[model samples]
Target: NAGVTQTPKFRILKIGQSMTLQCTQDMNHNYMYWYRQDPGMGLKLIYYSVGAGITDKGEVPNGYNVSRSTTEDFPLRLELAAPSQTSVYFCASSYSSGGHEQYFGPGTRLTVT
Candidate 1:
């Protein structure tokens, strides 16, 4: 609650299943981002929002959708999940974008079988 927090630490879904990965921050950051980390690979941005009511796609946003209805919440929705969607998802928040310090959540491990 003090920083970024993510729900459902771990989850497993069969092919075609869908889920929403929840994220929240108490720091009231205006910049929020979502990223996914695959095994042995660096994190790839899925989506980002500068503030509530403004959202944009990132490096890898094909299978994901995000909405920032409020400053505290940014949820990632995985639609028609596939095996390639399996990865560790991270949520981060910062007062400003680019070079600013960011607070990251513990992450949610999602496995799509």
Candidate 2:
């Protein structure tokens, strides 16, 4: 099984263009998260979902949106792409939030110009 997967490993978009980054996990995890990592910094949480139909914004949720409609899929959407949104996005999943180990996807590199 694919522990976690993200589509379109790399993407380039215009300033106004928009796209959806797909994330899926086959581990049946209850906690899912979206994080963005800048060129030379740590990962910043953008959004998280405890389970289906439950979602919350994280530290850096601006310009992005996420919806978790199933136990396996959590997709991040960029409504109006901007240059500042350029970063490497990662999708992670874990069984618990209390210091449990998390599984991460390969990541999606997005470039907005």
Candidate 3:
């Protein structure tokens, strides 16, 4: 299994442009999440999906959206990117929230101007 994979690794954006950061996991996990880690801070969840066809917003869901059309993929869509959105985006997946350590991809570093 590929665990998880994220595209671009790094990107720069202007004030109001938009982009989508791709994330995929081959572990067939039931839980997936998109989290942003700002400099010197804990990760804030942007969105989460418990399973295919089921998704919910998380703590810091603003300027972001997510969709889980399949068990292996969960991509984060950033609309109207802002400088505040500049941070490292990590795609993580777990078998269960209580008993599993989340597996993270290499991360996509986005710089919104």
State how far residue 36 of model 2 sits from its true place (Å): 0.5
Worst 10 residues of 2 by lDDT: 33-42
For residues 1-113, write the lDDT of model 1, one tens digit per residue: 46999998999999998899999999989999999999789999999999999999999999899999999999999989999998999999999987999889999999999
Give the C-alpha miss distance for residue 112 in model 3, angstroms.
Answer: 0.9
Query: Please, what is the TM-score per model?
Result: 0.97, 0.98, 0.96
Could you say which candidate leads in TM-score?
2
**Backbone clashes in each candidate structure, one number apiece?**
0, 0, 0
Which wins on lDDT, candidate 1 or candidate 2? 2
Give one digit per residue, the lDDT tens place, for model 3 in 1-113: 77899998999999999999999999989999999999879899989999999999999998898999999999999889999999999999999888788999999999987
Once model 3 is optimally superposed onto the true structure by TM-score, how far is the C-alpha of residue 71 displaced, in angstroms?
Answer: 0.5
What is residue 93's positional error in candidate 2, in angstroms? 0.3
Q: Indicate the residue-level lDDT of 98 in model 1.
A: 79
1-113, model 2: which lDDT tens digit per residue?
98999998999999999899999999999999999999778999999999999999999999999998899999999999999999999999999888999999999999999
Which residue pairs in candidate 3 have backbone atoms (N, alpha carbon, C) closer than 3 angstroms, thus clashing? none
Off by over 4 Å in 3: none
Q: Spell out the clash pairs found in candidate 2.
A: none
